[model samples]
Target chain A: MAVCPDFSIPAPFFYVNTFYDILYQSEDAKRIFGEHANFFSLIDVESRRKFQRLAERRFEPQKFELLLNTVQSPAMLFDIHLKWNRDNHCSILCIEQSQRYQQITEVLTRFTQRLGMTNYDLLRRKEELERLLANLQQSNAQNDRLVELGRIAASIAHEIRNPLTSIRGLVQLLAPNLTSSAKLSYIDIIISEINRVNSIITEFLKTAKPAPPLKEAIPVTDLFAELELLCHSESLLQGIELVILPVDPSLMIYADRLQMKQVLLNMLHNAMEAISDLPNSRTGMIQFEAERFGRYVQIRIEDNGVGMDEQTRTHLFSPFFTTKNSGTGLGLSTCYHIVELHGGTIDVESTPGHGTVFRIYLPTVDKKPELS
Target chain B: MNATHNNRFFQASLDLTDSIRMKIIQFAHILLSGDERKSWEFIEQQLVNGIHSTEIFCTYIPLAMTYIGELWIENAISVVDEHIASCVCDYLIMRYQAQYITPPDQQNCQAVVACVDGDPHELGAKLAVLLLNRHGLQTHYLGVHCPLHHFLAFISKWRPSIVALSVTQSHHLKKVQDYLEALQGLPYQPEIIVGGRLIHHLSYTSSKGAPNKQRLFFMQNLHELAGWLEQDYLPIKPE
Candidate 1:
């Protein structure tokens, strides 16, 4: 309303009365807020409240900040300076601070990028630590197993060595004395029995010092194929139906191939033996299956044979435990040890007249990251 | 272990007014008969039908075991039958817990559930572990008959925030007291939650002399325990 006065300052400046009537505006301010805009209409609500609080104080030179609506931006932050003149009108100056805000935003973006990298590094390191811990546990279990085996191996050697040697020597000496076919067959049986004893001793020694597992991702179907091939002849000989269910192609486990085969073979051998004892009138059958169960691969071997009682089931994994007449009592315990060494567990359930089921749960290897 | 299924297993849905109660009764009968396969089938079917796991655990399993206990109390079943039923229930609970896959990002709230020495019943403790685990807690279940020294050694190593003890027999009060005293001796004291069939015995002034009574809580049933866990104890959101 006053005659258009030229301001001395070059920055965006304004003069307004106590009611916020725009008495004067610099050319730059006019370009930003428009020619006829009120001072209150230029700021956001929050800044209006702040301005009201500031106005309640005594009229003096003051410096503050406000978010202003300008031609360039919706809510631009501005450093505002205000002073009251003798005419009771206030003169105001606003310095745009968008460049400073941009610098602060750049710093924050860098901070967040660094934080994300740190989180990824921490996760990678945690995975490494977990792998190391698993290896340490496996080593500890192996050491304990070796110590227990050493204790039993010494006594077993002392008990079997001299008798085995004498039996071999006697069989060789009597080889020429056998003239008839029936006598030759008896000598053959004696030699084979001695060889079986020697083989049992060797198998027991292998349990004492097992090679560390060469763990790798292996498809379960491939392993099952090998097992079916190896057990095919034995199943044919015993007339037991060995039915291995088809495994999922994507199911995989981290394990030693040879040791895993040994575990399956041992279980298959036990299953066949169990079925061989069944009556001829009843048909014998063994079912082998492997499936993904949560984070583990569950290998299940079930047999419709003469099952074991609770007492036998409890001691089935002991070092020198067996219920068979010609059994060495070492196969199952060795299987148990090998499974433990692979960071797996084996559980058995059986009813005396029905059947037995052996379930081996091994940790699965996840190939897809998104699946997790 | 027995993967084969047959008609004896319960696979059909129910249509009774009190379906949960009927299921509980039938499950108790199955457990008493030592038919684990049937019981597993029943549970799996329930889970497959979209029943909430909390209802299955906090209502079905515990209620079934309680019915078995009641039958044993009334002399309908022998002691051996009761033991067999308990063992079957324990095995199913073990298998069920083994199948739980916790989310990797969930922050763990550690808990230890055990039965006092000389208490033969562990179903209550096992159920507690299952329910707590379902609520985003990492629980270690030390089954019945763990010696005190071994327990203390484990507790010192594990240093859980909660210790849950199940006591079925009132005569095991001495063992509970011993455990409480030993737990108090540790550098980190956990909140002790005592619950079981004989939980009311503690309310009869016998727990006044127990060590760290301020930290002891008597939970009547799993529902109350779960409520407490949701309202006060569960520090993380349930998954």
Candidate 2:
């Protein structure tokens, strides 16, 4: 007799109206059946109870045959055929079939494991795809902003050039006839306004132009040190403390030095403006800090001042949206567009009573060259 | 000579009796085995041996066993794991189904198969495509959870004779109804057939609250669906 200790039959095998006596039993049978020499008696109470319940009812024997064939057992299933055979005094037949059950279970277990691995792989791939999609979306939004800025710059240039030419002509005409003191004062105002218009045009041109590729790594700490010296001179004259916190050393970013400096200057100017209207009783303090974030470097400029409400903050980076009467709102908006063009993001956090904090994140160079 | 003749007659009778018994045993065994692959193979072999397709599928023994297996096994494997197995079996079934292909003299037919919005399960939809294609119907399969507008546009363009919508989740019934409403206003509206586990859950009520009133046919399984499509929907010529 062929006896399989472990379930190894690839398919279920069934016997109808036949019973065989066991000549030899494997260790697995001994372990599973345990002390019961007769295979029919080896069935556990639960199996016997199910068998009994099935026998009591006018059960369709075929219905339970599939379940029987798929489970490991040392049990006998009695149906109408067997009942008739017993009534006729014919010997009942029992066969060893647990190997088939074990085989089916093993296949099912392997199938489930394979399914689980596939799901995990798919989930991981989906997450990676979502992240890439988010990055693409952000890049698209930045492109839209750049296009808007380009239109604004073109219109501003067209509008201001004619007025500037007319003003220059009028100033020259008035210069020849005025008294010396009056002439000097008038000329000074005209010259200053002319310079202001020229500076606006220069800034507009810088924003509209495509950025040159970054050629060298610039250390952020060194840049901030130089900015501190400039802020210190102005702060001392204005009676405000420009606190410069030295960031962690070895922090570097890939960017053009001149462009980065321009961005920082704009941020500093905004910070200074925010703190200018602080109550006399409270000391105005502007803080500069930097830190490394995952795949990006972050820089923050914080100031204690009369902060803006939600409405002002929402349109803070919009062109020509400003709180100051004398200010051209392009300062911060230009800073926003410039930072975005360099593949960086800027965010502002503020409460009505608490001061504003401008946080900027710039992407880090990949450790290895990206495979195309 | 008489004894020899008697022995031969007795032997022939026994052989004939055993043959019939073997057939019954094999039928029960296939049902009892409940392995979908084996049962499908048996059915295909029978068909190849000149058994009528309808007769081979008339008995629900295999499908019933499949239902039982589904119920007994907890946490059954996902569709992706079964895709390979399904594809192999479906290929075989498709081959048999191809026998019913419309001859050159018959008119061409077109159909659309899709999964309703939020129902990402496309196994049923895939089966529908195979069956429809095998029957010589040009089937356009819009894979899964297509937006209603896209479905409407495709319908407007293709003007298929029938549209089969499969829904695995019951919650998608609302979206499917909305899609049907959108189709009602269109210039061309195809007959919509619904199937899957969710269709079984839909309660029968008066037409007053019945959504998607125009086109709704509930099918139990792929086999039943095939029969329904062939008997009810396919255009037949007068003999």
Give the share of true interchain contacts found in each model.
0.00, 0.00
Two-chain DockQ for model 2: 0.01
Best by TM-score: 1
Span of 10 residues, lowest total lDDT, candidate 2 chain B = B71-80
User: Which residue pairs of candidate 2 clash?
Assistant: A7-A99, A18-A93, A19-A93, A19-A94
Listed in order, each prediction's TM-score against the native is 0.34, 0.29
Docking class of 1: incorrect
DockQ of every candidate: 0.01, 0.01
Total clashing pairs for each candidate: 0, 4
Q: In candidate 1, list every pair of residues with a backbone clash.
A: none
Residues A56-93 of candidate 2 have per-residue lDDT tens digits of: 32322222221122133322232212221222222222
All candidates: TM-score of chain A: 0.45, 0.44
The lDDT of each candidate is 0.74, 0.58
Off by more than 4 A, model 2: A1-372, B1-41, B49-51, B54-65, B68-85, B94-109, B118-120, B130-136, B203-215, B222-227, B234-239
